[model samples]
Target: MTDSQGQTPDTRRDFERFYAASVKRLVTVVYAVTGDLGEAEDAVQEAYARAWPRWEQLVAEGDPTPWVRTVALRLAVSSWRRTRNRVRAHFRHGPPPDLPGLAPDHVALVAALRHLNPEQRRAVVLHHLLDLPVEEVARQTGSTSTAVRSRLMRARRVLSAHLTDSPDTPTAGAGRPATAAQPRQEVLPHE
Candidate 1:
């Protein structure tokens, strides 16, 4: 098949090969972005579907993985935004039912994430948690490298302060030195 871009798109055999090669990596990126396995799978599938018609354009550009990832992340973010509104409405209307098997530490971590503004959280996750270089993050986020670096610096400072002040940390007067038993788990939004 040829695409509007006047390039020969992938044939059935080519698509099969591509899917077999790329699905796992694409899903991993989606999972990192969405933080929900089910949603990540759905989003990645959707992106793959969209990419199908544009296969020629993608193949011509060489390596469609990044394009697929961008689409998946966008879809995941859209879904998250919609769900967030529903959650807010549920909170306002009535008491929420308890979720079972939710660890307190996990709850605390989510709360800590909520404390950060979205950009700061994204910067922290993309850089520190994902181990992406500043340039890559800047490219993904459409920001200058310097801006990404600045945001990462600010995020680290804020996170450090927040962790240090948490009740889990020991005070100077305590016989033992203050250190969290388990290091905080960082969620990388883009990996």
Candidate 2:
């Protein structure tokens, strides 16, 4: 099948090639955005699936990659918002009174995480929890590496303070959080 642009209107073969070429990179970027590998992969896959029907049109227009990227990102954000709303509704009273097996330190850490803004929390999760490099984190989060560095620096400072202050939270440092000011040093983009 041919489209008006003289491109193949049928997407199966082209879509297969496109999927094989783009899936990994898309999943990586989406993972950075969603901070969940499963969610990221799902979003990208869903985006590609949606694009399948319009593949010829998308390719005729321009790069299907960016279109897929945008759609996947929007899907991720929409899913996040929906999940957040559900959690809010579920915890209208509170966070289920905390789990019984949760250690005191864990509870305090969870509390501190809850105190952080969404972006800060994401910075923490992507860089720290998920162990993504700063550059990858920046790419996924749609921010510059410098911005991701700043977010991590600030988030670390806040987490350190929060942990240090909590009786249950223990610290390996000298019990003092580092000031925002620091000796000039290059931040590692990939660590």
Q: Which candidate gets the maximum TM-score versus the true structure?
A: 1
User: In model 1, what is the error at residue 146, expressed in angstroms?
Assistant: 2.4
> What tens-digit string does per-residue lDDT give for candidate 1 at 52-109?
8777678789988768877877887788787987545643443223534546554334
Q: Tell me, by lDDT, which candidate is best.
A: 2
Residue 23 error for model 2, in Å? 0.3
lDDT string, candidate 2, 17-36, tens digits: 88899897777665544544
What's the CA error at residue 48 for candidate 2, in Å?
Answer: 0.5
**TM-scores for every candidate against the unseen true structure:** 0.58, 0.46
Record all residue pairs in model 2 with backbone atoms less than 3 Å apart, i.e. clashing. Answer: none
Runs off by more than 4 Å, candidate 1: 1-10, 87-117, 124-131, 157-191
